[model samples]
Target: MQTQSVQKNNVHKKSRSSLSVYLGQWNAPVVGYVFIAPWLIGFLVLQLWPIIQSFYLSFTEYSLLDAPHWIGSANYENIAKDRLFFNSLKVTFTYVLASVPLKLAAALFIAILLNRSIRGISVYRTLIYLPSLIGGSMAVAVLWRNIFGTDGFINNLVVLFGFTPHNWIGMPETALSTLIILSAWQFGSSMIIFLAGLKQIPSELYEASSVDGAGPVRKFISVTLPMLSPVILFNLIMGIINSFQMFTQAFIVTEGKPYNSTEVYALFLYKKAFGSLEMGYASALAWILLIIIGIMTLLNFIASKYWVFYESESGASK
Candidate 1:
């Protein structure tokens, strides 16, 4: 009886040790999965699922009121002849090309000015960044519309300067330009990013360039630009992406008015999806936009080989 009891005790101890080993091996992974589960689930449901559905829906006619009818490639074929599609694409390209450079230039300029060591610098940054905080809101867009209206502040200010009052957002020729100007005005985010990049740059490089009799422009060209190239690449890609996806300001301010002059790709997509309820067609447009953005990003990266300097690759020849 004693021998049997001792064998049972040994078996119990062995089982407990095995159980502990298993738990120990899985503990970290289990915790990690638990932590990531929320984000993973949200992404799968909100983002990934919608993407897959949109791709599938692109091949079918799906109105909210009815079932999705399989009409393979019809939507894409229609898109080939869609005049509005072409027009919106043109407007979007113009906005992206024009606004991005202007925005980057403004951001870099402000960043340089703010990078100075002086009293109340933090306050200045806060004040400057304040515009970006409200830039994308509906209220801001409404305010912008009011500001550029016929009897608006802009016209009033111009009238005071002995100029004829013109409606900025009323005319087709100037409508898209107003949106572009608004885009450039909201450069605070990019400015902040540029400022951060400037902060990371080594003062030693500037001092060395100064010792070599390099003036401000020469140092900026040689030392500042080379060091800031990576940051520029990052900002440029982000600006392009954001500009391509711009909708809120255009929607609230212009609503693609004055002969669809400000009809950007996103606004057009929204109109197709919701206004006309051409779900399938809108889905195709969305996919095409994704492809375009992807191609542009790839091209940027490919071109960046010549311009985007990395500190880690300093020893490598261009």
Candidate 2:
């Protein structure tokens, strides 16, 4: 009887202890949530609400001055028929396609070079990264515009080389190309990511490749490429997304000038929203952009299975 009683008491104690531990764990999560409540609330109020409202507004005909009237896909239909819309879409797609690959390639190349053991390497990294921090700013956009202007740095360089100075910014053929170059100039962030990915690659693999009589190019192709595939994939996605959403530089620099040569989708949307006061149409455009980005991301994920490498997972398994 005494032994049974003692055992029961121990069981009761264990149950209480377990309950206390569970409560403690629960309290920590609650406290953490409480701490993060402000940010959560802000995201819901600012981002989530705006996204939901925009989706609803897309089906309507709304101007800021008046109540929205539901038009039932009229905005989407109009967008299909709109010449400017198609032009902007083409321009935006061109920009994204051209800029992202070039930019990423430049970044990866620079990253590989900088990954070597060199004196004051940190300074070189900082210098390269500085452009990314500044390139997206209004000031930098203005500077770019000036540099490409008729009487600007580029034209002056042409004059020095005994060539006739040409209008750079005012020319439709070259204006968009200038923007592409600008986009490529800000490759520092991608380079940093590539550097990080390079660091994660094991040095032993390189040694093994060397022992197998693999040259630099062969080693890069066989070992480095496979190991860095994941990072390459990441940079590709991010670069594509960012390029698709490019706005500030074009907005400040060209303002869709030279016969709409630089008129990207985002700028077109902005013009519709604020300039023409077509809120509903602008909202539809936003939704379309969101859908495009989603589709692209989905496609990338699907394609990644064939190329992207996981440390522990086989390609066939993926």
Taken over the whole model, the C-alpha lDDT of each candidate is 0.95, 0.93
Please identify model 2 stretches exceeding 4 Å from their true place. 1-32, 315-318
Question: Residue by residue across 50-164, what tens digits does model 2's lDDT show?
Answer: 9999999999999999999999999999999999999998899999999999999899999999998889999999998998988789999999999998889999999999999
List per-candidate RMSD values in Å. Answer: 3.8, 5.7
Model 1 bad stretches (over 4 Å): 1-19, 27-31, 316-318
Top candidate on lDDT is 1
- Pairs that collide, model 2: none
Question: Where is model 1 poorest over a 10-residue stretch in terms of lDDT?
Answer: 309-318
Candidate 1 residue pairs that clash: none
Give the per-residue Cα lDDT of candidate 2 at 16. Answer: 100
Top candidate on TM-score is 1
* Model 1: per-residue Cα lDDT over 110-184, one tens digit each: 999999999999999999999999999999999999999999999999999999999789899899999999999
